[model samples]
Target: MLPGVVGTIQATEAVKLLLGIGEPLIGRLLTYDALGMRFREVRLRRDPKCPLCGTAPTITDLAVHRNGAGGACDVSPDGHPEGVAAAVAPKAGG
Candidate 1:
Protein backbone atom coordinates (compact mmCIF):
# COMPACT_ATOMS: atom_id res chain seq x y z
CA MET A 1 0.00 0.00 0.00
CA LEU A 2 1.19 3.51 -0.82
CA PRO A 3 1.63 5.87 2.11
CA GLY A 4 -0.87 8.73 2.32
CA VAL A 5 2.08 11.17 2.36
CA VAL A 6 3.11 10.09 -1.12
CA GLY A 7 -0.35 10.66 -2.50
CA THR A 8 -0.50 14.09 -0.89
CA ILE A 9 2.84 15.16 -2.36
CA GLN A 10 1.88 14.04 -5.84
CA ALA A 11 -1.46 15.80 -5.62
CA THR A 12 0.15 19.02 -4.39
CA GLU A 13 2.84 19.01 -7.07
CA ALA A 14 0.29 18.31 -9.80
CA VAL A 15 -1.90 21.14 -8.59
CA LYS A 16 1.00 23.58 -8.36
CA LEU A 17 2.39 22.81 -11.81
CA LEU A 18 -0.91 22.49 -13.64
CA LEU A 19 -2.81 25.37 -12.03
CA GLY A 20 0.14 27.53 -10.94
CA ILE A 21 -1.98 28.87 -8.07
CA GLY A 22 -0.10 27.53 -5.04
CA GLU A 23 3.60 27.77 -4.22
CA PRO A 24 5.62 24.67 -4.98
CA LEU A 25 7.47 23.42 -1.89
CA ILE A 26 9.24 20.19 -2.62
CA GLY A 27 11.58 20.02 0.39
CA ARG A 28 9.34 21.53 3.03
CA LEU A 29 6.27 19.72 4.26
CA LEU A 30 2.77 20.99 3.77
CA THR A 31 -0.11 20.56 6.17
CA TYR A 32 -3.85 20.43 5.62
CA ASP A 33 -6.19 21.25 8.49
CA ALA A 34 -9.90 20.77 8.01
CA LEU A 35 -13.03 19.68 9.84
CA GLY A 36 -11.28 19.35 13.23
CA MET A 37 -8.49 17.29 11.65
CA ARG A 38 -4.89 17.99 10.63
CA PHE A 39 -2.51 16.36 8.16
CA ARG A 40 1.22 16.92 7.63
CA GLU A 41 3.99 16.16 5.14
CA VAL A 42 4.10 14.18 1.91
CA ARG A 43 6.33 11.55 0.31
CA LEU A 44 6.84 10.43 -3.26
CA ARG A 45 8.09 7.28 -5.03
CA ARG A 46 9.01 6.38 -8.58
CA ASP A 47 8.58 3.16 -10.52
CA PRO A 48 12.06 2.48 -11.85
CA LYS A 49 11.13 -0.11 -14.48
CA CYS A 50 7.49 0.63 -15.06
CA PRO A 51 6.51 0.27 -18.70
CA LEU A 52 4.22 3.27 -18.58
CA CYS A 53 6.80 5.50 -16.91
CA GLY A 54 10.02 3.66 -17.65
CA THR A 55 12.34 3.15 -20.63
CA ALA A 56 10.65 -0.01 -21.93
CA PRO A 57 8.19 -0.04 -24.81
CA THR A 58 5.56 -2.71 -24.20
CA ILE A 59 1.92 -2.24 -23.37
CA THR A 60 -1.25 -4.36 -23.08
CA ASP A 61 -4.89 -3.61 -22.50
CA LEU A 62 -6.98 -5.45 -19.96
CA ALA A 63 -10.55 -5.94 -21.12
CA VAL A 64 -13.19 -6.64 -18.47
CA HIS A 65 -16.63 -8.11 -19.16
CA ARG A 66 -19.75 -8.74 -17.13
CA ASN A 67 -22.13 -11.65 -17.83
CA GLY A 68 -25.89 -11.81 -17.39
CA ALA A 69 -25.42 -13.12 -13.87
CA GLY A 70 -23.87 -9.80 -12.91
CA GLY A 71 -20.49 -11.49 -12.48
CA ALA A 72 -17.23 -10.32 -13.96
CA CYS A 73 -15.30 -12.31 -16.58
CA ASP A 74 -11.75 -11.97 -17.73
CA VAL A 75 -10.61 -12.74 -21.23
CA SER A 76 -7.86 -15.32 -21.40
CA PRO A 77 -4.74 -15.06 -23.49
CA ASP A 78 -6.18 -17.62 -25.99
CA GLY A 79 -9.16 -15.32 -26.64
CA HIS A 80 -11.58 -17.34 -24.53
CA PRO A 81 -13.91 -15.62 -22.14
CA GLU A 82 -13.47 -17.00 -18.63
CA GLY A 83 -16.79 -17.17 -16.87
CA VAL A 84 -17.10 -16.40 -13.18
CA ALA A 85 -19.97 -17.82 -11.17
CA ALA A 86 -22.07 -15.41 -9.20
CA ALA A 87 -22.26 -15.76 -5.47
CA VAL A 88 -25.66 -16.93 -4.29
CA ALA A 89 -27.07 -16.87 -0.79
CA PRO A 90 -28.72 -20.03 0.53
CA LYS A 91 -32.37 -19.82 1.49
CA ALA A 92 -33.19 -19.69 5.17
CA GLY A 93 -35.13 -22.96 5.03
CA GLY A 94 -32.31 -24.81 3.38
Candidate 2:
Protein backbone atom coordinates (compact mmCIF):
# COMPACT_ATOMS: atom_id res chain seq x y z
CA MET A 1 0.00 0.00 0.00
CA LEU A 2 1.21 3.51 -0.76
CA PRO A 3 1.94 5.11 2.60
CA GLY A 4 1.01 8.64 1.57
CA VAL A 5 -2.57 7.77 0.69
CA VAL A 6 -3.07 5.18 3.43
CA GLY A 7 -1.35 7.21 6.14
CA THR A 8 -3.61 10.19 5.59
CA ILE A 9 -6.73 8.02 6.02
CA GLN A 10 -5.32 6.38 9.13
CA ALA A 11 -4.40 9.75 10.66
CA THR A 12 -7.86 11.12 9.98
CA GLU A 13 -9.51 8.07 11.51
CA ALA A 14 -7.31 8.28 14.60
CA VAL A 15 -8.44 11.87 15.21
CA LYS A 16 -12.06 10.86 14.75
CA LEU A 17 -11.57 8.07 17.29
CA LEU A 18 -10.09 10.51 19.82
CA LEU A 19 -12.82 13.13 19.44
CA GLY A 20 -15.72 10.65 19.19
CA ILE A 21 -17.47 13.09 16.86
CA GLY A 22 -17.98 10.71 13.93
CA GLU A 23 -17.80 7.02 13.14
CA PRO A 24 -14.25 5.73 12.95
CA LEU A 25 -13.23 3.55 10.02
CA ILE A 26 -13.15 0.48 12.23
CA GLY A 27 -13.35 -2.85 10.32
CA ARG A 28 -13.23 -0.97 7.05
CA LEU A 29 -10.66 0.20 4.53
CA LEU A 30 -10.67 3.62 2.88
CA THR A 31 -8.97 4.93 -0.25
CA TYR A 32 -8.69 8.62 -0.95
CA ASP A 33 -7.49 11.00 -3.62
CA ALA A 34 -6.64 14.55 -2.64
CA LEU A 35 -6.33 16.03 -6.14
CA GLY A 36 -9.46 14.32 -7.38
CA MET A 37 -11.24 14.83 -4.05
CA ARG A 38 -12.63 11.30 -3.90
CA PHE A 39 -13.08 8.85 -1.04
CA ARG A 40 -13.94 5.18 -1.22
CA GLU A 41 -14.69 2.70 1.55
CA VAL A 42 -14.24 -1.03 1.54
CA ARG A 43 -15.57 -3.14 4.41
CA LEU A 44 -12.96 -5.40 5.93
CA ARG A 45 -13.70 -9.00 6.72
CA ARG A 46 -12.00 -11.60 8.90
CA ASP A 47 -10.08 -14.21 6.96
CA PRO A 48 -10.54 -17.84 7.86
CA LYS A 49 -7.21 -18.88 6.28
CA CYS A 50 -4.97 -16.10 7.58
CA PRO A 51 -2.16 -17.45 9.72
CA LEU A 52 -2.29 -14.51 12.16
CA CYS A 53 -6.07 -14.06 12.32
CA GLY A 54 -7.59 -17.31 11.12
CA THR A 55 -10.22 -19.23 13.06
CA ALA A 56 -7.70 -21.96 13.87
CA PRO A 57 -4.58 -19.85 13.90
CA THR A 58 -1.20 -21.52 13.51
CA ILE A 59 0.89 -18.56 14.61
CA THR A 60 0.44 -18.42 18.40
CA ASP A 61 3.70 -16.87 19.62
CA LEU A 62 4.73 -13.25 19.29
CA ALA A 63 8.33 -14.47 19.31
CA VAL A 64 7.69 -15.91 15.86
CA HIS A 65 7.26 -12.36 14.62
CA ARG A 66 10.55 -11.28 16.21
CA ASN A 67 13.91 -11.60 14.48
CA GLY A 68 15.51 -14.90 15.39
CA ALA A 69 18.82 -13.23 14.57
CA GLY A 70 18.30 -10.57 17.25
CA GLY A 71 19.37 -7.08 16.18
CA ALA A 72 20.69 -7.98 12.70
CA CYS A 73 18.71 -6.47 9.85
CA ASP A 74 18.47 -7.34 6.16
CA VAL A 75 17.29 -4.89 3.54
CA SER A 76 14.24 -5.94 1.55
CA PRO A 77 13.92 -5.26 -2.17
CA ASP A 78 11.69 -2.34 -1.20
CA GLY A 79 14.30 -1.09 1.31
CA HIS A 80 12.65 -2.23 4.53
CA PRO A 81 14.36 -4.21 7.27
CA GLU A 82 14.02 -7.98 7.35
CA GLY A 83 15.94 -10.01 9.92
CA VAL A 84 19.23 -11.66 9.05
CA ALA A 85 21.09 -14.08 11.31
CA ALA A 86 24.23 -12.91 13.09
CA ALA A 87 27.31 -14.11 11.23
CA VAL A 88 30.34 -12.79 13.09
CA ALA A 89 30.84 -14.55 16.42
CA PRO A 90 30.45 -12.57 19.62
CA LYS A 91 32.45 -13.07 22.84
CA ALA A 92 30.36 -14.94 25.33
CA GLY A 93 28.81 -13.02 28.28
CA GLY A 94 29.82 -9.65 26.85
Candidate 3:
Protein backbone atom coordinates (compact mmCIF):
# COMPACT_ATOMS: atom_id res chain seq x y z
CA MET A 1 0.00 0.00 0.00
CA LEU A 2 2.75 2.42 0.87
CA PRO A 3 4.71 1.47 -2.23
CA GLY A 4 1.63 1.98 -4.41
CA VAL A 5 1.00 5.43 -3.00
CA VAL A 6 4.69 6.46 -3.34
CA GLY A 7 4.94 5.02 -6.83
CA THR A 8 1.85 6.90 -7.92
CA ILE A 9 3.30 10.14 -6.60
CA GLN A 10 6.61 9.51 -8.38
CA ALA A 11 4.82 8.69 -11.65
CA THR A 12 2.67 11.79 -11.35
CA GLU A 13 5.74 13.93 -10.79
CA ALA A 14 7.50 12.39 -13.79
CA VAL A 15 4.49 13.00 -16.01
CA LYS A 16 4.22 16.59 -14.88
CA LEU A 17 7.92 17.11 -15.55
CA LEU A 18 7.70 15.56 -19.02
CA LEU A 19 4.62 17.59 -19.94
CA GLY A 20 5.93 20.74 -18.21
CA ILE A 21 2.55 21.21 -16.59
CA GLY A 22 1.70 22.09 -12.99
CA GLU A 23 4.13 22.86 -10.19
CA PRO A 24 6.52 20.02 -9.47
CA LEU A 25 8.33 19.30 -6.24
CA ILE A 26 11.81 20.35 -7.31
CA GLY A 27 13.37 21.76 -4.16
CA ARG A 28 10.56 20.77 -1.85
CA LEU A 29 10.40 17.51 0.04
CA LEU A 30 7.15 15.60 0.40
CA THR A 31 6.90 13.53 3.57
CA TYR A 32 4.00 11.17 4.07
CA ASP A 33 2.95 10.02 7.52
CA ALA A 34 1.10 6.78 6.91
CA LEU A 35 0.36 6.23 10.60
CA GLY A 36 -1.31 9.64 10.89
CA MET A 37 -2.52 9.77 7.28
CA ARG A 38 -0.93 13.13 6.76
CA PHE A 39 1.33 14.71 4.18
CA ARG A 40 3.87 17.47 4.75
CA GLU A 41 5.77 19.68 2.36
CA VAL A 42 9.20 20.91 3.34
CA ARG A 43 10.81 23.67 1.32
CA LEU A 44 14.51 23.03 0.84
CA ARG A 45 17.06 25.80 0.60
CA ARG A 46 20.39 25.69 -1.14
CA ASP A 47 23.36 25.72 1.21
CA PRO A 48 25.93 28.27 0.23
CA LYS A 49 28.65 26.27 1.94
CA CYS A 50 27.85 23.04 0.15
CA PRO A 51 30.75 21.69 -1.88
CA LEU A 52 28.64 20.55 -4.82
CA CYS A 53 26.30 23.51 -5.31
CA GLY A 54 28.04 26.10 -3.26
CA THR A 55 29.14 29.51 -4.46
CA ALA A 56 32.74 28.30 -4.67
CA PRO A 57 32.39 24.68 -5.62
CA THR A 58 35.62 22.70 -5.44
CA ILE A 59 34.27 19.91 -7.61
CA THR A 60 33.64 21.50 -10.97
CA ASP A 61 34.12 18.42 -13.09
CA LEU A 62 33.72 14.63 -12.95
CA ALA A 63 37.38 13.92 -13.54
CA VAL A 64 37.79 12.84 -9.94
CA HIS A 65 35.55 9.82 -10.65
CA ARG A 66 37.85 8.62 -13.42
CA ASN A 67 39.78 6.53 -10.88
CA GLY A 68 36.69 5.18 -9.20
CA ALA A 69 35.90 1.57 -8.39
CA GLY A 70 37.46 -0.58 -11.14
CA GLY A 71 37.73 2.66 -13.16
CA ALA A 72 33.96 2.52 -13.64
CA CYS A 73 33.13 5.91 -12.13
CA ASP A 74 30.98 4.21 -9.54
CA VAL A 75 32.68 5.09 -6.25
CA SER A 76 36.16 5.42 -4.84
CA PRO A 77 37.78 2.95 -2.45
CA ASP A 78 36.77 5.28 0.38
CA GLY A 79 33.10 4.67 -0.34
CA HIS A 80 32.69 8.30 -1.44
CA PRO A 81 33.26 10.35 -4.55
CA GLU A 82 36.76 11.73 -4.89
CA GLY A 83 37.34 15.46 -4.27
CA VAL A 84 34.05 15.57 -2.42
CA ALA A 85 33.43 15.69 1.28
CA ALA A 86 31.65 12.73 2.79
CA ALA A 87 28.66 13.51 4.94
CA VAL A 88 29.49 12.33 8.45
CA ALA A 89 27.56 13.11 11.58
CA PRO A 90 29.48 14.14 14.70
CA LYS A 91 29.77 11.51 17.38
CA ALA A 92 27.49 11.98 20.35
CA GLY A 93 29.27 13.70 23.26
CA GLY A 94 32.53 13.70 21.31
Candidate 4:
Protein backbone atom coordinates (compact mmCIF):
# COMPACT_ATOMS: atom_id res chain seq x y z
CA MET A 1 0.00 0.00 0.00
CA LEU A 2 2.72 2.43 0.97
CA PRO A 3 4.86 1.57 -2.04
CA GLY A 4 1.91 1.97 -4.40
CA VAL A 5 1.21 5.43 -3.06
CA VAL A 6 4.84 6.46 -3.44
CA GLY A 7 5.10 5.00 -6.92
CA THR A 8 1.99 6.83 -8.06
CA ILE A 9 3.39 10.09 -6.76
CA GLN A 10 6.68 9.46 -8.52
CA ALA A 11 4.94 8.62 -11.80
CA THR A 12 2.82 11.72 -11.57
CA GLU A 13 5.89 13.83 -10.94
CA ALA A 14 7.61 12.31 -13.97
CA VAL A 15 4.66 13.13 -16.22
CA LYS A 16 4.53 16.67 -14.94
CA LEU A 17 8.22 17.13 -15.55
CA LEU A 18 8.09 15.70 -19.06
CA LEU A 19 5.03 17.78 -20.05
CA GLY A 20 5.98 20.86 -18.03
CA ILE A 21 2.36 21.09 -17.07
CA GLY A 22 2.47 21.67 -13.33
CA GLU A 23 5.01 22.31 -10.60
CA PRO A 24 7.40 19.45 -9.94
CA LEU A 25 9.13 18.35 -6.77
CA ILE A 26 12.52 19.62 -7.79
CA GLY A 27 14.58 21.15 -4.97
CA ARG A 28 12.01 19.94 -2.52
CA LEU A 29 11.38 16.92 -0.33
CA LEU A 30 7.95 15.36 -0.03
CA THR A 31 7.51 13.06 2.94
CA TYR A 32 4.55 10.82 3.67
CA ASP A 33 3.50 9.89 7.17
CA ALA A 34 1.34 6.83 6.85
CA LEU A 35 0.55 6.66 10.53
CA GLY A 36 -0.76 10.20 10.54
CA MET A 37 -2.07 10.13 6.96
CA ARG A 38 -0.20 13.31 6.26
CA PHE A 39 2.11 14.66 3.59
CA ARG A 40 4.73 17.32 4.15
CA GLU A 41 6.97 19.31 1.87
CA VAL A 42 10.37 20.69 2.70
CA ARG A 43 12.55 22.92 0.55
CA LEU A 44 15.95 21.52 -0.34
CA ARG A 45 19.18 23.28 -1.22
CA ARG A 46 21.66 21.93 -3.73
CA ASP A 47 25.06 21.10 -2.35
CA PRO A 48 27.89 22.32 -4.50
CA LYS A 49 30.10 19.49 -3.21
CA CYS A 50 27.65 16.70 -4.04
CA PRO A 51 29.43 14.04 -6.08
CA LEU A 52 26.72 13.53 -8.72
CA CYS A 53 24.90 16.87 -8.70
CA GLY A 54 27.70 19.22 -7.74
CA THR A 55 29.27 21.96 -9.83
CA ALA A 56 32.25 19.66 -10.57
CA PRO A 57 30.68 16.21 -10.42
CA THR A 58 33.06 13.28 -10.50
CA ILE A 59 30.39 10.73 -11.47
CA THR A 60 29.46 12.38 -14.75
CA ASP A 61 30.74 9.45 -16.81
CA LEU A 62 29.58 5.83 -17.04
CA ALA A 63 33.05 4.39 -16.41
CA VAL A 64 32.02 3.09 -13.04
CA HIS A 65 29.35 0.86 -14.58
CA ARG A 66 31.62 -0.46 -17.30
CA ASN A 67 34.21 -1.93 -14.94
CA GLY A 68 31.97 -4.98 -14.24
CA ALA A 69 33.77 -5.82 -10.98
CA GLY A 70 30.83 -4.78 -8.86
CA GLY A 71 31.20 -1.34 -10.47
CA ALA A 72 28.31 0.78 -9.24
CA CYS A 73 27.06 -2.09 -7.11
CA ASP A 74 30.24 -2.16 -5.03
CA VAL A 75 29.50 -0.14 -1.95
CA SER A 76 33.08 0.02 -0.69
CA PRO A 77 35.50 2.36 -2.48
CA ASP A 78 38.50 0.31 -1.20
CA GLY A 79 37.56 -2.62 -3.47
CA HIS A 80 36.36 -4.83 -0.61
CA PRO A 81 33.32 -7.00 -1.27
CA GLU A 82 30.02 -5.56 -0.23
CA GLY A 83 29.19 -6.02 3.50
CA VAL A 84 32.86 -6.85 4.21
CA ALA A 85 35.00 -4.43 6.14
CA ALA A 86 37.96 -2.98 4.29
CA ALA A 87 40.14 -3.08 7.39
CA VAL A 88 40.16 -5.04 10.61
CA ALA A 89 41.56 -3.88 13.92
CA PRO A 90 44.65 -5.65 15.28
CA LYS A 91 44.16 -7.95 18.23
CA ALA A 92 45.14 -6.43 21.61
CA GLY A 93 48.89 -7.08 22.18
CA GLY A 94 49.02 -9.42 19.20
Q: Tell me each candidate's RMSD, in Å, in order.
A: 14.4, 13.2, 9.0, 11.9
- Tens-digit lDDT track of model 2 for 28-79: 6665656777876666666555555767665666655486855333323343
Assess each prediction's global lDDT (C-alpha) against the native: 0.46, 0.58, 0.66, 0.67
Q: What residue runs in model 4 are displaced by over 4 Å at the alpha carbon?
A: 65-94
RMSD of model 4 against the true structure: 11.9
What value does the lDDT take at residue 67 in candidate 2? 69
Give TM per candidate: 0.28, 0.48, 0.62, 0.61
User: In lDDT terms, which candidate is top?
Assistant: 4
Model 3, residue 18: distance off in Å is 0.5
Instruction: Quote the lDDT for 74 in model 1.
Output: 37
- Residue 78, candidate 2: Cα error in Å is 24
User: Which segments of candidate 3 are over 4 A away from where they belong?
Assistant: 62-94
Q: Which runs of model 1 end up more than 4 angstroms from their true locations?
A: 1-36, 60-94
lDDT of 3 at 11: 96
